[model samples]
Target: MFLPDVHAEPDTEVLFQFIKENPLGLLITGINSTSVDFLQCTHAPFVLDLPNAGDNTTPRLRAHVAKQNPQVKAMIETLDTKPSETITLDQEVLVLFNGRHDHYVTPKFYTETKPDTGKVVPTWNYSAVQIYGKLSLYYDSKTPETGAFLGKQMHDLSEQCERSVMGFTGDGDRPQPWKVSDAPERYVELLQRNVVGIEIEIRKVEGKFKMSQEMRPGDREGVVKGVSRALTQVGVTCMGIHLYVPRQ
Candidate 1:
């Protein structure tokens, strides 16, 4: 997470939006930092809950995994914790969101404008957000809160994804969004029972948008054009500010 001040997004609001836009985050965890022998990486949809004004609660991200997942088993074993009850891992983990915005820029895009006459090399333009935090698992509920957290997490995550799939701005061709309640209650409950809920107590969040802002104006435009052609996005919000480079 090497965040340059020039590309950092300090505004929590923008970062939150970015997370929402990219829910399929990569969860990376390991048994110990000393070796990569037991490293586990998973990509899953996560729901972020931001603290409200005056609220003392810190931000948290929630997701779920099948009970059979090796990563889940390894985490439980590493912490010597039972999966039947709520448990938190002492080791911190990382979650990364790429937001489906990335592109390759060739030298041809910058040769004309760069100061070094046609000396520019190929590079990548992309945006990424990283979350560092301790992870907690909610399995069979030992308490009311723990038991209900799984259901709520599933419901909220499903609703958000449904909205995204159905189009927030409203698409005439799309049907009504789906919900957890749409399925038979017994079936939904049965499926939920076979999975485990997870929550991350976010200790820090970092955003990096490398959209060629460091390039000269003309070279920058060349980069943006390539990005625009690839991603259809001319503007991207840096972690705190906005980078008006289009990654077509």
Candidate 2:
């Protein structure tokens, strides 16, 4: 991920919060040094669980993918392979969550502060988190244990979104939050059969907040104002973006 020390975010809370806000993570597998053809990727929604987080516990991510997904087959192959003298059955994968709006900044944005410098170039501003974990695939989604797990995953993910900026909550004017049980039981059961559950025991996590933290103070504010005006023109609010200002 090429995370520099200057832009690195080492806080566990911040990483977890980013995953919660951006649950639709990209699951990447089959990262072999030999060939790129073996690589696989799947876009899936996830539920972050940090049960023992206070004690420096590693987080567990829960999500489900269609049974017919090619990535599912690749992971199962890893599980079925027996460890020999040089091989092991363990499969590690990456899940990437892109959490915020990314916009391009032009040199013109910094021209006011550095009129003759000509130092600023085009760059992008964004926030993202990368999670690396060992894959644990559950094939029996219909069993009581797996079914319960899937149910909880569905509930937690939907409820979290209900309370998010793009979602609705039953306040005075908004409609009530929706639930998984709102669907017909028979239909839900049929739908469940086509998917398999995935649980990731996270081994490591990294966060990158590239919000012009390295730029000069005046140039930083100028870039922010330029992007804000552009976003507002398109009816998009920019209140939630966290700004990074140098400490005095």
lDDT (Cα, 0-100) at 222 in candidate 2: 82
Candidate 1 per-residue lDDT over residues 204-245, each given as its tens digit = 898987777766777777665655554545455423222454
TM-scores for every candidate against the unseen true structure: 0.84, 0.86
Model 2 segments more than 4 A misplaced? 31-37, 53-57, 81-89, 165-167
Off by over 4 Å in 1: 32-37, 111-116, 141-143, 168-174, 229-248
Clashes of each: 12, 0
Q: What lDDT does model 2 reach? A: 0.76
Model 2: what TM-score? 0.86
- lDDT per residue, candidate 2, 1-248, as tens digits? 87876677888897998888778899997744332348889998888888763677667998888977877666554444431111222767899999658888887777455686776688888888999988766666556767777777777877877767455788878888888899898887887777777888898999988888888777888888888888889999987655686434
